[model samples]
Target: MMLAILIICSQITIPLPGVPLTLQTFAIGMIATMLPLRDCLLIIFTYLLIGSVGLPVFANFAGGLPILLSPLGGYLIGFLIYGLITSGILGLTSRSSLTICLANFLGAASQLIIGGLWLIPANHLTLSQAMTIGVIPFIIPGILKLFLVVIVAQRLLKARLLAR
Candidate 1:
């Protein structure tokens, strides 16, 4: 149920090119913290596959090969990394709110870093330019999403889904 919701949430976008803010990363982090690592990775991979096959499962209500080849591709790739870190962290720790929050925070940071690094090189953005356009506007939202992911993860964990 949660997996289905997350995948659909991933496709919701805010209509920005290369920067359509979506809950996919948050969902990934939350799922990672709640599910076992292998299941998390599989679900994330499947989500990506669904988008890659020309489905309108990406930003701007757009998908297909073109969107994948666009500038946002790097961030799309980074989603997988997001799952690995957050879920891996959750897997390593005993279930707790703080642990889940920390894992989501780190996962969010990793996603931001991955996006910034990829954007700089792909778009020929200098550090200052990239920081200005990519990282700065996102910090607050990212923090909020981190908090939300943590809350959701803890809720799922409390429901005894962590061991499933």
Candidate 2:
């Protein structure tokens, strides 16, 4: 549900070679920390399925197998890893603000890895070149996203705790 909503709100465009500022990453991290690992993966996969079927589920209102086959496809696949890593890390932590932040950062790193892998072959880039084109440009934004998602997750968890 959240992924669908985010997809509609967001659009896909590779400002760089492999990195797009879609809400997919943000949504993945948020869902990972909030939902169970299985559910998070389901949501990630569902989003892709929607996109693959030409639902415009990608960023910039782009979708279809063409997008998936594109360099950004790696990042799309990375969303699954992002969700799994974030959810798993949060599951092991004490549900504290600090740990949630750590989880988000780790999730972001995982997404970067996926993005880099996608860029290398798709863009004909080396590791260092891929990092420059696929990873470096997005670092600041990704960090900001991690901080924001952590803050929101912490607040939500805190509120739930208070409610209990």
Candidate 3:
């Protein structure tokens, strides 16, 4: 179910250079908020594995090692790390709004940071160029998604859908 959700989210893309903006962050947040770290990692790994094997599970219906190694590759790789950090934080600490907010922020930052760094090498871009396209543009959207995830996750947790 989560795997399907990730794939579905990937298709809700607004095409952009380097990487398309998608609802992938939304799905990633949901997965991070709702699942245990171990389970979350397993799910993210499976999602990446499928995409890497050319299942068209990535954003813009893209898949394969080429895509995995492209300028957008860091974000793809960052997803797993994002899952690890966010889910691990939630697993080990209180699930208060504040805690969730911090975890999400840190995890999201990790994605942008890693992705930005990857762009420098992959695209042979200067740091400023990578920051311009990779990190700066996504900050506000990432914050919005963070709040949405916190609200939805709390509600879902209260509803006991898989139980936190």
- Please name the candidate that would achieve the greatest TM-score relative to the true structure: 3
lDDT of 3 by residue, 95-139 (tens): 888988888888889988899989999999999999998999989
Worst 10 residues of 2 by lDDT: 9-18
Which digits, one per residue and each the tens of the lDDT, describe model 2 over residues 59-151? 877879988888888888888888888888877777777888888888889888888778888988899998888888888888887888888
Of the candidates numbered 2 and 3, which has the greater lDDT value? 3
Clash pairs, candidate 1, are: none
Give the poorly placed runs of model 1, Cα more than 4 Å off.
Answer: 16-18, 161-164
In model 2, residue pairs whose N, Cα or C atoms come closer than 3 Å (at least 3 residues apart or on different chains), thus clashing, are 11-59, 11-60, 12-59, 12-60
User: What are the models' TM-scores?
Assistant: 0.87, 0.90, 0.95
Candidates in order: C-alpha RMSD to true structure: 2.4, 2.0, 1.8
Q: Return model 1's CA RMSD, one decimal.
A: 2.4
lDDT of 3 at 116: 90
lDDT of 1 by residue, 9-105 (tens): 7777665545778877777777787788899888877777877887777655567776666667777777788888888987888768888877777
lDDT of 1: 0.76
The positional error of residue 87 in candidate 2, measured at the CA in angstroms, is 0.3
Model 2 RMSD to the real structure?
2.0
